[model samples]
Target: MRAPAANPREPRRHHYVPRLLMKRFAVERRPGQFQIQAFDKSNDRVFATAIENIAVESDFNALERDGVRVSLEAGMGKIESAAAEPIARIVQGGTLVGMTMEDRAAIDLFCALQFARGTGMRAQFSALAEGVEARARAIVGADARLDLVGDAEGMKAAALQLIVGSLLEFTGRFNDKDLLLLQAIEGEDFLLGDNPVAMQNARQFGPYGNIGLGVPGIEIYMPISSRFSLAYWCPTLLHQMREGAALADQRLLQARAMSVVGQGVTRAAALAALPEIEALRARLRRIPDGHLAGAAVAADAGNVTRLNSLQVRWAERFVMSRDGGFDIARRMIADDSAFRQGMRPRLD
Candidate 1:
């Protein structure tokens, strides 16, 4: 069933009110498949709640029909273009992008696990506005860099968006699995009745709190199927001063894996094709606009080349990660053995 209209217009520039903006709506791609999601802003959880081209009249459906904009009975309801991009394709059983192709069979199993975490975590924090504040505090701790605590205050949505921006920036280099690890950290129950360490420190490290057995107390930190996505991306943003992308834990692990296997990664093939990729990237550089139709074509081709180049860097980063390299250098590190054990990892 659809939620009754709370107000004619969605809240804007408002303080932290625990309002649930129904996220699920019917976006029919085919006859039976519809995309539905419940994005809890207060908890920062965005989960896809997909079903067949639904016929139900739920709050989400109402929200979709009547967008976040306020409706005007006496006036015209304004329509504006959406800035967000729709998912190009929803993988079967809903495999979020970036998961290893080797692990595609467990789609339903994976989503169920994610739902459990996001559901449990959001529920736990739905109340306790103070708890919400505290959670926000954890994100903006002494070591926090996204400046989430200070930037763009007063509005809950803005604060949450800033938090997302920061997370997007922070998790850039780490894999989605690492973020999943953080999600696991958020979900696990942390209390030390007698002991101070395991109860306090166990959640941060996997296996201790059980990787798949439990759900987190907070949704923002809950696990999702899109794991390890940032493990090899946005290194500069993730660690402003950390030298290389491998500074992120998961990337380091991948580097180790590459080192052990002795270079069978597709990254090598991608790197071998660098001149072609770079030439494509250079062609993209010539395009003046980021939104023109021709620009889109240029971008599509550029993105492929970039992806290939990124694959090469990722492979080298993988090797570099395996070694104890801490700097971002060139020439020496680019070489295999040096990448295997010496100075900084190369960037560019």
Candidate 2:
């Protein structure tokens, strides 16, 4: 069997390591007074209210510390209100160092509580790492796309790797703003350069390939995981769609058969189909603005059985909702142990 993949982080070994977070925040800035704020909630703080007030700078490179600065453009949003709180990580200079929440119910839904029950490695990363290797080979070998490299399965695997490896280094959140980066760079290799937020330490990778467009002065490198379909799974699916389209130009056989994640027929399309995930959206949106994890059990005896039985379904829904629809489903999953059991990763 193929050896279990090594951890994606480079250096492979490190004397001092930063702990992986369940909840985090990030910042990015570009020219023309535009900026992108990447929020990484660690999938842990499921209940943590979505903090909204925000602004990104134009020449953000000039910031002395990370991206922290007075809001030049206060975004009209707030994660939670008083009396009922939310979990939030403080971000300064592009580092998430601390967090806050309003109540116990909120805490119950966060990554702290959902650590295992609904916890999982980021799916976008999982799929991409498995997909890119194939695509990369398609680009490298043979004179033409039709005359090109390997089997469909193998090409998908290579594409997945390249994508995942690139994501591990993305500093941007999965949002509309990231498209520019995707447009500029060539998906064939490293996203190139440093995190736009920090022109200094350059670990972040996939810009989706926006570099060729000439983004200017500050070279931004983002952490690859930060790039793994942030906010929701919709954009992740969108990225794959575009990738498939690119493959189509390359005359890839399977490109035409793409589907939403979890809804497809073939191994190539399995993760693409997202039917059940689509079904649970309405129920999920009811989740209070708190943590993203409190999805095992409901807070009362009345919710026990039904909610528990629905845990896996809830996770299925959680992965599908492009908006806040699955957030409510997460609440149900957090309160029920039976639900927790249903959502397990399948040990066998």
Candidate 3:
């Protein structure tokens, strides 16, 4: 494990401009800072030079003032009506142009939220929020001639959506309701970054043959760290998806696969996969008597089967949407007698 930094803010967050886009600029790494010589692709002329971690108070003040001004204008109803039309245009144009306005908006919104919450990715995102929309438009416009379904253009769009989705879930903006909406909007097979089992399966299965061959969509694999982060924010969503009837068999299979992966990791390997286990542990801990003392005891005793059962049951109750199996899980966890006697087998 990496040691914690002395200063909580010692390691400043870094934002990577993709290489495809970076080629449009001159980039250099100085001793303690990085520099970018950005150019306007339209005119092929230098536009600006950006040095990382360098910002003046006025820069932040300007952005803050803009945010405040917009808010005040909206509240006063001066901008509210005008905002809707432009927003609708952005969404419609973005969809038809294969530009992900929602994704970019999510990034900008989350970054602002983080800054407002004093978590401080403020410098990084404040700068990004300035030109993100323009950059996204440039990218989409440039890639427009390429295939929209499975080409590099499509990959970039999917990647952006994945990143936005990951960030939203990471920042606690994702919820069970969001999951339901997402499922309805994008179909059940939409790649959920929080679903480690499904993600791992995708990696193991490799890119399906149909992938990139003109299928309507493609799955984008997210970094394990992002999925791990989801455990903190969307345990409820995870629980709902895990036990919900919508993707029951697939979810169960993925859960089992995750368990197997957890069992197989070596200490070094375990460090990497620790997040997923931690997520599982975090989800389990939501239940009464589901902490280290109770669940850990079973784990330490080599009762993997029992431990897994407990985890599944715990998740089932932690966010039971409707009755069905949920009621049984709830009763099993709530009733001391049932808890001590252990969960019963269902005959129905």
Candidate 4:
């Protein structure tokens, strides 16, 4: 028989969502002690705790490889460190503007890591593994000498591999979308979930939701702070915006020409149109391999609520904010049975 895997010496409290990101939505409970208000969906309870105490699982990233036990916690820490400055800048300015290419890439990887490393994702992978094992067992019948699912160590190894691989896969896909920083309107705030990266497709509905990162109309939201959120707009949506802007400009120009004949109206019209043109350009434009803070948009109360609804739906267990405000989340849970289950893979 194979020897059992040894316990890893690495950090046990592995945080899937980085503490740096969580700290943005934290309140200073005491001197140098920050606390965030969290609502646990499982128990239907709201509580206050440090950011370090939540969004974590014991040895969640630990794995056995080459007869050695290791954890990906350190590697995850490095990703958080890389993204710290850029994200902090966005929170401070309440915009996604003026980020460097490297900063953008770092944030992309970090977001992917957050999505892949969550309990929701890990549970989905586990369920998939179980389903495959069940099918394999039935196919092999009594002739099977070993468990198709392999040992715990082997499973851990596989999970670790999948998490890292997904992070890398998603980073490139996230790069394809247009980055925007969304600011919550006055008297409204964004919420953070255990699974912070809330993904949805506005163009898709019914039993077939398009969760694919590369798919058009995919909307990805991550609340960086209670006041600001990071969003990735679908390429299709950006295309539509650009097309609409062009058509509007053309119509306005034609109308001006028809109304004012044989005057130097072209120059005056162009000058007058400069501000509108710049505004549209900022909205529809992006820096090559970077992000523009000018793309920041204000989210009205309705918009903020809509985004928070995603956080509630995407969260595995808890949805939190700077304050213990969960009126929307509470209502959703009470009204919809589906919201109680949150986002999970359909094994069937």
Candidate 5:
């Protein structure tokens, strides 16, 4: 008798930070692993770390210190060191904490779509969207039976719905007031205005401000997972600032705009769509299992076009109000070139 084969869809290893992070670090490949080092310019210190691809057991000790121990098992990874409490708090209920390698890839695919939009490049955005659809098709086909042509559109819809549904599921786990505050804090102009102190104070006492157990200021540092969750539901903004604006400033504006839109969607409208999200997930799960052969590749070109159209429509419909403190913040950050452009549409 032969042993069973491992799931082909599963990745051989997992990385908390993607390879892009290497851009900020000096990396050296050694035998089977990589040593990464970063120099902190402000502190004049060097930090070094190593990573490697290795088989992780379903359950195993990760780290231990001062009689405290952390473990990773069954999709859940934890750190119990008192010194690591901050890390623990930030990641406590993240979708990534317990997710398998394959699922992480799916989530990352969706994240890439968000990042692509942040790039303010139309071509990049379309490419990423098509990539996501193609990946989703491959994963779905591998796990289930389906007719590519007959169900390609349906599958694409299902994939989008699944992304949104999963995000809703995560949001649903929190209380209403907490959810509301989370949305507000994540807003682009939340901390901006004439009175920065007053704004900060307001956030400190907001509904979800003191909610994170034993984690002071947790609201200010939302988990990366939440960012992606919001990204899935929002449209990306284009960089329409006038020429001569600093590229770095434009990039920051794009990021903040993306955050605002993502957070904005979490309000009443998203809550009202909870039932629809559930239905979408249910429908996605009902698809039969089998390989769809070349269906995934066949739909790539069409999906790219569809994705671009969807993004454009979403961007057009999204309007940002200038009455709030947001106007002041935008003007403060805008370069002379951008000011002349006169408030190009807010990404959110």
Candidate 6:
């Protein structure tokens, strides 16, 4: 006799990084079992676990709202389903060319949600709360605050509210950027961190410099699989690819001026009136209607290494690799004192 079916509403384990994605970096252990290599930064050790085991927590996305039991797992599952096909096609084709606008929107939403929903962000929220509490205590000189501060479940609910609230705004920023496919050369693969979306400023290397999503020269890197990682380049930097950096900066100023004046006019009319603006916009559009209808150029070794390093530095916990190679991570941890200490708040 068969046992009772599992309850969809009462899922115990929920993944921050959707398993649909983890499967790309996982190895088939047996007939249906899949496993991926994991490197724990705390212990400075490497291990492997089933794909379902890592990047998951119990009731991570489940919470109560207005006295109703609500689970976001189902909604997140829908997003995973929507993105699976387009992601598979891109991985198989090994390129971003010829992708439909609908597909681009799907992937953009997936990456944005992935960026917001994670243990890393949760930890950051917790740290920020603690910082605020410390300051409050200093000013008031007393242990007087709401119970929410120390209550684990309450904190989780608050974090979820913030995550879901700002999702659309974050996705908008992602949509404004253009995709730059970073293809790994033969025998090379990208690592997937617990906090998979690595946000950085390639132009500015100062430790405390601004790397906000809307800031100029911001680069958002998300590893799609072992073979491909998507680098969303800001418009200014994308312009810099053809023109020099200085010219790209100047062009952005001009574009901003046009954008301000073109507010009242319809987009079509504005483009019709401004030939130069139309040409610049056309150059920035990479996916649809672009001539790059083939595989993207393979990234150099240095590029791959730098991308991998971002995964390490930005990660809140362990980072995973497809081939169980941890030499790069190990070397970095051994040499860098900060890494050994563990992940700290980006500002602090």
TM-scores, each model vs. reference: 0.20, 0.17, 0.19, 0.81, 0.20, 0.79
Candidate with the greatest TM-score versus the true structure = 4
Estimate the overall C-alpha local distance difference test score of candidate 4.
0.78
lDDT (0 to 1) per candidate: 0.26, 0.26, 0.27, 0.78, 0.28, 0.76
- How good is model 5 by TM-score? 0.20
Query: What is the per-residue lDDT of model 5 for residues 7-93, given as tens digits with 9 covering 90 to 100?
Result: 455443433233222211223465545444322212223344452321122212122334543222212211112213322222344
> Model 6, which residues run further than 4 Å from truth?
1-10, 65-67, 142-148, 203-209, 245-294, 340-348
> Runs in model 5 with CA error above 4 Å?
1-4, 28-34, 38-47, 50-165, 168-202, 206-208, 211-348
Backbone Cα, N, C clashes tallied per candidate: 24, 85, 0, 2, 6, 0
Candidate 1's C-alpha runs over 4 A off are 1-128, 131-155, 173-348
- Misplaced by over 4 Å in model 4 are 1-9, 65-67, 130-155, 205-209, 254-293
As for TM-score, the candidate ahead, 4 or 5, is 4
Residue 193 of candidate 2: its Cα lDDT?
A: 9
Determine the backbone clash count of candidate 4: 2
Q: Compute the lDDT of residue 68 as modeled in candidate 6.
A: 62
How would you order the candidates by TM-score, starting with the best? 4, 6, 1, 5, 3, 2
Error of 2 at 7 (Å): 22
Candidate 4 lDDT, 1-348, residue by residue in tens: 443554555578888777887787898877777899999988788999998899887777876555566678888889989998899888887666677899999999888887777777765666667777777777877476645566665666776787766777888888888888888888998999888888888676557657867877898998888998888878777677767667666756665554456347765776576567556555554322234335567788998999999999988888888979999888998898677655766544
Assess candidate 3 and give its TM-score to the true structure: 0.19
Name the best candidate (by lDDT).
4
lDDT tens readout by residue for model 3, 183-266: 012111111110111111112223343222112222212111100111111233334434543344444445556656655454
CA lDDT for candidate 6: 0.76
Least well predicted 10-residue stretch by lDDT in candidate 3: 187-196
